[model samples]
Target: MRDKVVAFVPIKLNSQRLPHKNILPFGDHSLSWYIFKNLLNVAGIDEIYVFCSDEIIMNYIPEGVKFLQRDSYLDGDMVQGHEIYQSFVNLVDGDIYLLAHTTSPFLTSKSIENALLNMLSGKYDSALSVQQKQTFIWYDGKPLNYDSSNIPRTQDIMPIYMETSGFYMFKKEHLLTYGRRIGFNPYFQKLNDIEAIDIDTREDYEFALKILETNKQIPIC
Candidate 1:
């Protein structure tokens, strides 16, 4: 029998850019709570597990969300993602895993569902979010995506993608092989500007709130 698809959220309380980022007030609930609630709306996910070492986040976790208490040592800001990700794959039971973060509030459930559908299409080994850029790109004082000899019109510039780290979906085998979130031949799904907003600084946090409120993306209860 094929195993189930699980959504994994690795959230930490410590932050340098924004203090107590995970549980900070983001609208009605904390930042983590907002994201967790959206994850619940997504269908086809058998389990939704949140791995955190902080006790404050425990208060916001509602039903359908499994809380995994992580080791305090792993809570250190210096702890890398791969270390925790490898542990998650080993400890969690799932054939496919969707890795999401609470900080990227713009990543809605619909985007995740679409990404998963594309991921399971069998054209790519993995899938992740990105932002499209269609401006003049330079590398080492040289033009990229344009021929220096025949500098094309600005409108004709080929677009490039910026990995947003908003969300990622990968098979267990890919995680076991590379010990990373993405694998070779990973598909990049470009997101709209609003959907690509990642909160790291105070400016970003404020901007995200504005976007959510202006668009009425906030869930009504």
Candidate 2:
């Protein structure tokens, strides 16, 4: 039997960086509408659910998508992100889980479907969306991904993989065993800067709006 792919979006009303970030209006719908709708269009996803604490979120979701009311305590200010994720995985039963976020509105369904197909192929234990960057990066006051002594052209340098909260495809057993979305062997799904956009602040939201306004390739609702 094929593994069941369950895609879910876990959201909370509290947002210190961008107030009500998930529900903020984007085009004709809320910010989260795009991801949810995008998932619905994917053929690989067996089920789609919005795991949230508030019932008001239902207003933002489209028809056919299900809602799973999560425990309010999971949204506590002191609670860690992993704790909340573990709780949801424990509650819902599925062979595989696709952890998606509302902030990543530009992640195309083609990329998502391709990642899901890879997971179904059984070659990879998990998969994550990442943006490849060849720009200079520093960590702990030291150059990373490139040697400073022999600085090379940006395009010639080895690219760095930065994780995006856009989506994570993992087997249920892998998550239950390691308590992490990325497994021992993870497939890095490459995404361009536009597709990897994660709206965390007001500025990011504005930038996304600008993209939608100018990027005719992106579907508008």
Candidate 3:
């Protein structure tokens, strides 16, 4: 039998960088509206869990979506994403879990389904969105991917993949048993820079708007 795919979106009212960001107006829909709408369009997703605490944001949640009331303790500024996941593992059931966020406002449904397909393929126990940055890299004030004495073409440099946190999918047992989001072997799904942009600062939010306008393919789910 095939495994079921459940998506969990952890939301809170207080945002350190942008207060009430999850509910912030973005075009005709709020920040999370896009993700919610897109996920609804995804046939691969068995369920979409809107894990939230703020009632104000509930208004943004569309009809027929599953609402998971988050504990007030997990809504604090210091609470980590993994901490929230710990709370979810005790509640939800699925062979594969898709954990995403409103911060990734432009996360494409195609990407979401693709990630789910990758997870179901069993190539890796887990999968998440990432961006390929094939640029100059460095660490601890030392050249990381290139040599100071001998320079190589940009194409010759090994590309570095950065976790975009746009979306993630993992086997339910992988998380519940190991207490980690990903298993020993994980698949990194590469996403384009524009599609993988994460909303962290004010500028990032604005950038997402531009992307949304340029690409009309993103529909309201």
Candidate 4:
């Protein structure tokens, strides 16, 4: 049997950009619910833990899911995600750990399943969701490479990888040693922009709603 995998979702009510974004309803469910539900559905994921600060949000959580109130120090805006991830790692002892953000509502179970399969089969130390993009390269408000003559087509520019903040998987031991979801040896799983949406601002939340509405997948309940 495959080792049990524990998933920790970090959430907080306070947000400078979009307050209470996690509990905000996009369709029939809140943004956090979408992510939590997907995590529950993924194969090989043995447990799902919501490391949150708000108590009201806990009431809506489905039965069987675990909730861990975040420490005050880790609840601050300046706190890094690595700190919260490590805290949960210490609480739950699992073979593999998956850190997912509540803001990423577009993430699907299949995407998570594939990532897990790749990690186990490929023997990767860690894996993260990324967007494979290779558009015009720019830096510090200046175009670094505008001439396509020297470089290959945008599709062939070695595929610039951007962390989508969608999902990350790592071995428990590797995470504790490296103190990051991405361990020493990390692998990337590419996701489309639509599936990589992370709600940080009002504009982002609104955009996700539009996408779900257009697709007619918005939960009715």
Candidate 5:
């Protein structure tokens, strides 16, 4: 039997960096609408739910998507992300879960489909979207992805895979057992810079809007 995939977008109405960013206007619909619509179009998603505490979010979402009323306490500023994940996984039943966020407005269905397909293939236990950047990276005041002694060109440096807040594909059981979205055996789904844009701050949101404005023909979802 094929595994059942349940995709969800967790929305918190009160955003600290950019207040009400999730419901902010993005093209014809709100910010969350893009990922919601994209998930709806993905072929293998058994169900799509908007896990949020606010019912007002209904107005922003498109039809055919169900809603789940989450506890408002999960929206607390001190709440750790894993707590919310655990809460949702315990509430919803599915063999696999596609965790997406409204901040990832440019996350395309193609990237989501590819990641879902890879997870279904059984070659890997989990998958998450990432962007490859070949730049000088420093951690703890030391070069992380390169050797300062060698001083190689940027292109010559090994590419660092940066995790994007776009989406995560993982087994439900694994999350329940390990309390992790990224399983031990995982696949990194590469996405272009534009497609991986996540709107966290005002600058990020403005940048995303600029991208859409620059290309009028670009698909909002």
Candidate 6:
């Protein structure tokens, strides 16, 4: 039998950068609702779990979505994403797990499908959505490069990739066995910066709203 694919969306209420951001409305619906709806539209997803601790955010959860009330131990600002992923691993029985965030509303079903397909191709133990970046990187007030004066064209340089906090896919057994989000090998699914935007501050929230208004169109859920 094929393993079922489950999506776990972890949302915490307390945010130092943007307080109560999960429940904040983007256009007409709460932020969490937008993500939850998108997950539901994906073709191969068997279950969608919304993990949250805030009552205000919980109250707005739409129908047809599973709600997992987060425990106090896992509801702190310092809690890592791996902790939340492990918590869901304990509660559910699925072969594949997809960890996503509520702050990124631009994640489309096509992107989700691509990530899953790439993970299934056997080239990687886990796959994550990332934004490929190319810029002069600095560390400790010093440039870290093989040739200090060689600032090649942005396109020529090897692009730096970052996990966009949009989505992650991994096998449940791999997570339980390794105690990590990814195993020995991980693959990256490159995404555009606009599609990878996550709300971390008031400025970011404003930017998301502006993007939504400017587009005047939300991708099909």
Best by lDDT: 5
State the local distance difference test value for candidate 6. Answer: 0.80
Per-prediction RMSD in angstroms?
2.1, 1.8, 1.9, 2.6, 1.4, 2.1
Off by over 4 Å in 3: 213-221
| TM-scores of the candidates in the order shown | 0.91, 0.94, 0.92, 0.89, 0.95, 0.90
lDDT (0-100) at residue 215 of candidate 2?
A: 81
C-alpha lDDT score of every prediction, in listed order: 0.80, 0.88, 0.81, 0.79, 0.89, 0.80
* Deviation from native of the Cα of residue 120 in model 5, angstroms: 0.6
Error of 3 at 86 (Å): 1.2
Comparing 2 and 3 on TM-score, the stronger one: 2
Model 5 lDDT, full chain set:
0.89
Worst 10 residues of 3 by lDDT: 212-221
Tens-digit per-residue lDDT, 95-212, candidate 4 = 8888888887778878888888888875787789998777787778765655545766776565468899889998887767767678776778887777888888899988888999
Please say which candidate is ahead in lDDT: 1 or 5.
Answer: 5
The parts of candidate 6 lying over 4 Å away from their true place are 54-59
Q: Judged by lDDT relative to the true structure, which candidate is superior, 1 or 3? A: 3
Best by TM-score: 5
Number of backbone-clashing residue pairs for each candidate, in the order shown: 0, 0, 1, 0, 0, 0
2 versus 6: better lDDT goes to: 2
Question: How do all the candidates rank in terms of TM-score, highest first?
Answer: 5, 2, 3, 1, 6, 4
Q: Identify the superior model by lDDT, candidate 4 or candidate 6.
A: 6
